[model samples]
Target chain A: MSKAVIPGMIARKTGHIINIGSTAGKEVYPKGNVYCASKYAVDALTKGMRIDLLPHGIKVTQIAPGMAETEFRSVRFGGDGPVRHRFTKVWTRCGRRTSPNWCTM
Target chain B: MRGRRAQAVEVRGLIDGLMVVRLAERGRQVKPEDQQQQRKGTHDPQMCWLACELTASGEQEVAWSTGPHAKVAFLCPMPKLILITGATSGFGEATARRFAAEGHRVIITGRRKERLEALRSELEGMHGKVEARRSFILFTSTCATMPLCKRSFPPTGMERDRCAGEQCGPRRRAGPDPGRPSRGLGAHAGHQLKACCT
Candidate 1:
């Protein structure tokens, strides 16, 4: 992605690359090996891109969001609708909407 | 439910945070002292506060979560061309919508062609032009199919080379991978294995 658009950004001498990361990238959990690894790679790549593109005046920022109501939980649960529903129910019941629900799981 | 409302607020807060990052440098004059401070590895306090507010404080969420129709007073003077991946759903979709609502040109890529088209139409309806494509440029394991990126725009050679790093990891993704993975193991892996075996 950066490889494709970066040349044009360099030519123009300005660009902003905002990577949507996850809280999984910041902390590893018991069963989040693969997902966390991928996000960690994203976090690392964001920093790496920031450094490399510093000379080119391209800004690379990564926003690591905690869990929210999205298809992300469904995808993470392998499309198991019932499990995700029950999880979300339990999650909301506990009243931690702003806090990351990864630890409880 | 309160949870649902909270989720909506959280998502909107995220969109607001992204806007903050987008507008952080907007309409601000660069002073000699600021440049010297930047050179000295110090950042402006306001920028630091904005950055910290994103990750630390709930004040940002409260500030932007006034209502669904809330709009930032200051808009970007020039609409930026933004490329967002995984825009079929989740945060990506929200971000795309936020930016498109602000009248920025966007290029959104994802695996689901139907969803991508739907979003493209919805965003185009909201603002102006939007480019949608089915490109998986993130995972290098899927890079073998880089040349097959025949969309509205041509794939660059550097992009092809970046995807050419297919030999970096063991190939395991078989089922349910959103975008198509190239058939057969990457050819580069074959050469490397052959050399080591010989």
Candidate 2:
């Protein structure tokens, strides 16, 4: 996405790029190691893309949302299974503690 | 401690949303109207729909039991308008319910028309006044992707790249062209509204 937009950035000479990274990029969870690594890559990409495109007057940014209420829970917890139930309990109990002010979706 | 924690939570939430919008804006996937709608809190159909899903999926049962502390923890100030994608279920649905209850205009989108209709009816019944201008629902598979397609304006077959690092992340296929005009490159560049509100 960043690459495709580079042209637009160059053409505009003043563009903004916002990367939707994740908290996983900043810190790894026990079960979410790979996901975290990908996010880290995103973090790196944001910096690299920003610096590379800075000459064109483009601004780069990254957003790393954590524990947002979305389909992520269902996907992670195992869709209508016991894992779902247990994870839901843990999520409801611990989500606010870990993520603080989280939003849905 | 509790009050401080709540304040921290609120800040984080705002930051997260802002971050996403900033990222989207930087990426150029967002349109000016979309940004304006987002600022009004009526953009990002996925989030609104997720809220509705959470509400309908028996989560409302937990809302009361979660207690005042939890309420404070989860309480989000209503935006003037909200756009949600993937709103058929889960977080999107729950968000829609919450926003409507709080008297915000909401636009929802998803692949499922039935669910969207149901949600519209449900929200109207609950709010007593259907927010026609604020409430909208669309059927699109790539609804979350850039440049929302309204009923009157169909997509122009231009697929904006995915966010920076998704599975099929945007590939830099187009090389830098020195000859391209430097001004007015963005389709919606001059529009007063910026893209994707936080």
Candidate 3:
């Protein structure tokens, strides 16, 4: 993706790049060692890209979404039941403890 | 009986855009117009759209599925040009395949040039009706770790940086001698991701 944009960047001398990140990048999850590390790398890349490309009038942004209903969890856990239960229990417990009102369940 | 009752209430909410007033019991002096005004002040149009969809679908029973605003907006009139990395397998490959099937001009990239070539041939053969000019697959050695590789492309007329860094993953510290190009494990992974996006 970046390679495709390079030619344009050289031509216009400016550009912007947006990368999708996840909360997993900001905080580590159990058994998510490599994936977490990868997301962290994305965060670092966003910062670096911003600095390196800023002079050329390029902007870099990173969006780290939390608990989005994407295919991520199903794929990560290899199925829906076990991993979903575990994650829901953990997040629900955390939500209840942190903000009971917000934790409707 | 309990589930049936809940379903009836949910159906009512759907017909009324999930208004809190509609959920209130009979003769409950709830002013729905006021509540609607208050919600409109805080919620955006996309949120309103999502709320309507979820309530209509009866998924509102799930606590996590409370507001329509939680949904991601689907891009209409799909983009003509799309670039995907990690196109050799998994989500990237699936997405590239889907978009190409939808008749969009798609460019898929991956470090495994052979895999990309195979996919390209397969998609082209399958999508004979769609012009070959609309789809392409490119192979690149660099992965997600190296952004500089893509920085080399000539800028087309499109906005150069409208959504930069939004979809890119995190970065790691450059290994010693940044100038020296080394294909380590990290670089390989980086290349894989970059390949999909290209």
Candidate 4:
């Protein structure tokens, strides 16, 4: 998507690009290998964008959020009852303890 | 619920983060001595928080989101045309609201047409009429490749006419009008907001 609007930003010489990342990008979990890899890619991409867009006066920011109670959990679990319940308990405790710096609804 | 409170906190943080960036930008533009002098007695957390609150309340007349009013007023800036992808829910939705509340122009994109329209309506209702030409609801999926991204980037002919104006003609070249307060799409409208891969 950055590809689409970059030309115009180049012309104007100013813009801001904010990418939403995840804590999974910073650490790997037992069953979340693929998800971690994807988020790690986001981490790398944000850095690259900042470097490339710097001379153009465009600011790039990455907001890396940890697990929050959102549709993401349901989608990731695929609505499996027992497993969903188990993970929810684990996540809820972790969430309360640390209170993620960034969160999804 | 705890989840909802977390969302609210995170959303407030996101807006405050942006406000800090704007403050940093202002800092960079001014001389170091002036900034240092201006920083005297500015450590009052209560005053800073109050300034942010005033900004959140739509008091654009306050001049800036933070800092001393007299000095910051000169740096009071124009609203940016912000483009947010996956804006139907979650962080994107919250971020959209935070920025829209501050009177910035927001162009939201998502695959869910109904949800996108709903968000657009909700924001408009809160912020007053944001000219349709300046705000767009682009229905784009997460494209994986550069070629697919380039292809998906163009607005449909109907949207193009509504936004870019006739064959992507006259308006595209007109640039921004300095005299006016940016009523139409302006230079940024037609080719704005393409900052996501997913």
Top candidate (TM-score): 4
Q: In candidate 1, which residue pairs clash? A: none
TM-score of every candidate relative to the true structure: 0.50, 0.41, 0.41, 0.54
Residue-by-residue lDDT tens digits, candidate 1, B58-91: 2221112122233232223454545667777777
Q: Write the per-residue lDDT of candidate 4 for residues B1-198, one digit (tens) a residue.
A: 322111111111122222321222111122233223333334344444444444344432222233233222211246555678888877777677656655555667777888988877766554333344245445556542233223222322112223221222223234344344322222343444333321
DockQ of candidate model 1: 0.08
- Model 1 chain B: ten consecutive residues of lowest lDDT: B4-13
Q: For the second chain of model 2, what is the TM-score against the true structure's chain B?
A: 0.36
lDDT tens string, model 4, A1-105?
776656545545666788988889888888998989999999999998887777767788888776554567668867657777777688776654222213321
Give the range of the ten consecutive residues with the poorest summed lDDT in model 3 chain B: B7-16
Clash pairs, model 4 backbone: none
DockQ of 4: 0.15
lDDT of 1 by residue, A1-105 (tens): 555455434433566888878889999998889989999999999998887776767789998887666777768776867877787788788875532222211
> Model 4: chain B TM-score vs. truth?
0.38
User: Which ten residues in a row are the worst by lDDT in model 4 chain A?
Assistant: A96-105
Cα deviation at A10, candidate 3, in Å, is: 3.2
Docking class of 4: incorrect
